[model samples]
Target: MNLADVPKEKLSPMMQQYAATKEKYSDCILFFRLGDFYEMFFEDAILVSRELELTLTGKECGLDERAPMCGVPYHSVDLYLKKLVDRGYKIAICEQMTDPALSKGLVERDVIRIVTPGTLIESSMLDDNANNYICSLYYGTDGSCALCFADLSTGEMSLAVPQGTTDLTVRIMDMLSRYTPAELVLNAQALSLKSVMDFVKVRLQCAVTLRDDACFSLDTGRELICQQFGVDSLELLGIEEDGAGACAVCGMLDYIRETQKRNIARFISIDVVDSAETMGLDLNARRNLELTETIRGKERKGSMLWLLDDARTAMGKRLLKTWMEQPLVQPLKIMARLDAVEAFYKKSVSLMEVRALLDNVYDLERLMTRGLFQKASRKPHRVT
Candidate 1:
């Protein structure tokens, strides 16, 4: 169903509008806002109908044959969207900008936001204990690479620049395994790097996105970082503008703004992660150890985390997993963690009471972050 084959004059006014919007977002499934439903037409209609098991229907456009059509009720759109996103499909949510009843002609509609695997924030679409991270990778010509990880649901951003490594690929893959990002955004250089791209797309099975090269420029990155942190320069934050980390962060921020279609006030600061502080485990090592899941079935059973985890809340389980992946290298830090464990062991009664209290608690970190983002965007925030 190529629209290019159909003459513009043959399309009805409303369908002409859909064609124009769909042209701009050809990579995504455009959910065109119609009265009480988000409708799909032509290719989108046919594909969505089969995927969601919706009835295949037709509509009278200006053509001799009716246009293929299907739709889901707008109120229950999240369920359909979750299914599509989980299947690795991107969606462009076309929303009506004005009331149709008040308009004299066709209602004006535009894509308000894009929903991707990385940018998901709805509670129903996410796992409570896992962070859905969207990663940005910037590969410099000088053999340096920067990786940035951000969880849109939690508003947490962190960057890692692995330097002085003989095999940068191993370090890069190690970081990727630790975070297990749902999506990866790359610059021109990074996209051209065949090894990294293959590992991300094939081994990790992550969605890859390419943005404009200008977004990763050094000067642009510095300016965006300064503006985001309300600082005069990168020096104030101990970050070099020419560095790989800055480039990665800048590209990430640009990508997020593009998908979200608005400024994100959630990122108040950026954390520069020091890889030396923790024991570095490459991809193979993590897989062999089965730190989080078994290597065979990739399930939580028979894994180190499964054996050790007794967390009462979602946040605690996530924190435990984070700790398991990044073991502290410093003796003082290790001793501090052991001391805390010893204290909890000595006061079993108090620990039991604390666990009981945590059982009633929700994931406050993401809950509050989603509330703030929604309020800033002036949309309803749903947290379960």
Candidate 2:
């Protein structure tokens, strides 16, 4: 409910604190920490309760009329967050920052992270064989555009600048189709492009975020790139310091930092993408060919991926899908892949042994990245 809709009564100190925190993240559904429960107040409570089918209640906020409230236990909040995120709602995980036992009055609390469709890291919320990419795009005034895609869970980031193209919208759509990003962030210029915006919203149907133009500052982006990779210059990476690529990459990093509220994921490098290296498959091409899923039920059982996929591990399956999505166009690379497959085919017994070994291997890429986030802890203690 809007502030005008609420009863005119003085709020309790704790409720007042919630109001102040909610103001900062007006777009997100704030999970305000209240002892053992992550409480939702006012509009957040109403929305979440209606969506999740939870019983909406009320709390005394120093007013005769109780404030609307709903809550999910902190230990089991991931389940609730996943439901909301799948429906394209952003969540602000406000945590109790200070100990209540030692506090003089009201315990301090703040948002530790803002979880969006693209920023998911929990194993339960992710698909084992699919990369959950968060894309960032910057469309310059010169009709040139830069695209950045990063899988936060795997710490893999790649930048693509679709230059020398008559229709950059087509190139950008091709890139988006390949990655199938869960979330997209666009600068003011990119968002203003009608065709691209339509493709993103109507076709992709993923969560879209609009970032301030200032966030794509060239100088700041250059510095962020250097600091992130611990490099002196973007020259070594073949990215122009003042180019749209740097701006796109910087916007992505800035958005991630804003949402995560900490340096958890380590982006070791930013790989420059060459579109020509891979076969271009636009949305129509992919859909008609049924490259990954069938056209009817959209299941993998009758698709190209199903026929060739014999991967034993989650990582192998994911890599195979990546290879399927972006078929190598360069002769040398194709030959190298063929040679590796030939070697495995000739050594049948060795291949069997390799598959047996892989059966026991976990998804190490996600495991290592999740470990860095310190999310690998044991089950949280049940709060009484």
Candidate 3:
């Protein structure tokens, strides 16, 4: 719904303002900043009240029927947000834009940030050892598609183009399962593909957001990516000469702009992984091999990782998972890994000492992510 679609004639001053704001963020569950509370009204209130198991209450609107209303304390908004996001919902945080004490009539309010499952950086909202990847896929007219991944918690971004093959959907679906992003943004072209669309919604069970096809243009993509990465050209970022990968990156960036109104996911640098460089595994293969989890019960008990993993820290655990999923195809890289293991084995005393020291180590990478979110959303809780 747009502003015009809102029932302007029926709503009073505050309700009218809310109606307009709701129109703007129709797709999101908006938490409108009211005094001491982040309130939801109308349909959003009804949905959230049921989802969060909050009291389904009512508020006065200028109409015959009372408006549905629900809220949580502003100070504890993150608690509610976590619940909603965990259930695959996006939250738009509307904040009072002006000082209530100084304002003449009603306080001016605007969206501060829009939070989603994929872009959440708060420590309370993320898993310690798991990567929270937000991905975007762009489908080109030539039956080729590019995918990009961004992890807000680690500031790791990557891009890969699916190898040109007849069974493209299988490859794409496998890649999706491998990364396991919380949210995905697809261009119009990608969303149009029935097979791709079904895989995203059914197989991956990820929240899908759409972008315009024009945004996926190669020139715009290169310009947007180069600007964001602070590079002169795509070559510096190791993006392919073709723009499909860049387009996917730009589409993801655009979705960040839309969903994360205030805090966009930070990207320090990108690591481009070529498809041929790593061993690729499909869903069936992963299930049969029991690489991460057992086949029947789908638990970690009898998995290969369960047998091999003895990592001390969350970072080590996450890295180990990645290494297991995509073992090196290159012989030299494999040998280098073996050499490191051999060195560790040869010096048993040093290995034991190192392990002991690592036992006390904290997950600094996740700490950095939480710190970044705190800095971005840091503000005094004033009625403004």
Q: Which candidate, 2 or 3, has the higher TM-score?
A: 2
In order of appearance, the predictions have TM-scores of: 0.93, 0.95, 0.90
User: Which candidate do you rate higher for TM-score, 1 or 3?
Assistant: 1
Q: Can you write out model 2's per-residue Cα lDDT over 150-262, one digit (the tens) per residue?
A: 99888889999985545878788888999999999988888667887899889899999999988888766787778888889988877887789888988999999999998
Best by lDDT: 2
Output the TM-score of candidate 3: 0.90
Clashing pairs in 3: none
> Model 1 scores what on Cα lDDT?
0.85
Candidate 1, TM-score vs. the true structure?
0.93
What number of clashing residue pairs does each candidate have, in the order they appear?
A: 0, 0, 0
- The predicted structure with the larger lDDT, 2 or 3, is 2
Model 2 poorest ten-residue lDDT run:
375-384
* CA error at residue 233 for candidate 2, angstroms: 0.7
Each prediction's Cα lDDT score?
A: 0.85, 0.87, 0.81
Local accuracy of candidate 3 as per-residue lDDT tens digits, 1-384: 223444688888998889888888888898999889999987788899999899978888787678889899988887999999988998888999998989999989988788988888776677665688899998888877888998877778888778846488877887887897899988887866788778778867888877787666666667777778888988898887576887888887777766666435467678887877788887678879999889899888799988998888878888998888887899998999999999999999999999888887777776666665663344311110
- Clashing pairs for model 2 are none
Off by over 4 Å in 2: 4-9, 377-384
